[model samples]
Every structure is written in C-alpha cells, then in structure tokens.
Target: MSRTNIDIDDELVTMAMRLYNLRTKREAVNYALRQLVGDPMTLEEALAMKGVGWEGDLDAIKGGGPIEDLDDIDLDLLPQDLGDLDARDDR
Candidate 1:
C-alpha cells in the first residue's frame, strides 16, 4: 500500500466512518475511494432483467392498488431462500 499525506475534513471522515460502519480513518477513506471508483452496471444491463423471477403481477401492480391489497398475496409465493444475489457471477 502507498501512503501519502493529505488534508481531509474531519467531520466528513467521521460521518463516513459512521455511515459505512468503518472503524478507522484509513478504512473509511479506503471504503470511500472504492465507492467512488466502483464499477456500476450500465442502464442496458438493468433493463435486461425484464422481471425474470418476479412472481407478482406487473399489470395489477401498475394500477397502484391500496396497501391492504398486499394482504391477499400468498406468503408462500414469495421466495423462501434468497441466496446472495450480490455474489452471483451472472451479473
């Protein structure tokens, strides 16, 4: 790791530490840097999902039904085990 002396706002660092749940200033700074330069998916990739695994009815949902409508939904229809989607290589 390369070390360099630089000035940074103490309040901002403290906020970052709390927000990111990081312990040290170094960890906070590194986490911030990684977030700043992280590889985000393109719009095309996001649009490609096309509600592949969604069990809900998109048309009925589009009507913006009352919150009480949620009660009618079968709890069993929902995913039982949502294994780490973040760690999926297909993404």
Candidate 2:
C-alpha cells in the first residue's frame, strides 16, 4: 500500500473511531474509506446473504401491509421535544 501524508478533520476521525469501534486512526480511516467507495463483498457473497437465518419479516417492514390514515393519529400523543439541540444563531 502507498503511504501518503494528508490533512483530515480530527472531529470526523474521532466520530468514525467511536462509530466503528476501531482501535486505531488507520483502522478508522480505512473503514470509512471502504464504506465510501469500496464494496469488499462479491456478488456471490452478497447473494449468499439472502435466507441466512434472518427471522424478521422483511416484507412487513418494507410497507407491504395496510397503511393507516394520518387522521387516525392522535397529535397529543406525540413527544413535545424532538431533542435538546442548541438553537443556531445562523438561522
């Protein structure tokens, strides 16, 4: 592999390390780069993933069942605050 020095965002690297649970900066960067542009699995490997003991009903989860009308929803039951995000002054 060719080694090169390049500038990268520290915050992004930290986030990637935490998200992927990688032990090193090299591992984190490699994982992130693979995710962005690499498909390490072959077609046979990808096709093999089907019916590999996954018990969940994929069709039901993909909206194959009957859909409910929005009017049927109770607005009062919804959570008031989505998250405690800081208000942006840029707005």
* Tens-place lDDT digits, model 1, residues 7-84: 988997998888656799999888777666985745763575557766766556445555577667656655668876
Candidate 1 colliding pairs: none
lDDT top scorer:
1
Minimum summed lDDT over a 10-residue window in model 2 is located at: 82-91
Q: Write the per-residue lDDT of candidate 2 for residues 1-91, one digit (tens) a residue.
A: 8897889878878987786567888988877777669758657546756765555455544455454776654455554564545643423
For each candidate, the alpha-carbon lDDT, in order, equals 0.72, 0.66
Q: How accurate is candidate 1 locally (lDDT)?
A: 0.72
Model 2: per-residue Cα lDDT at residue 85 = 54
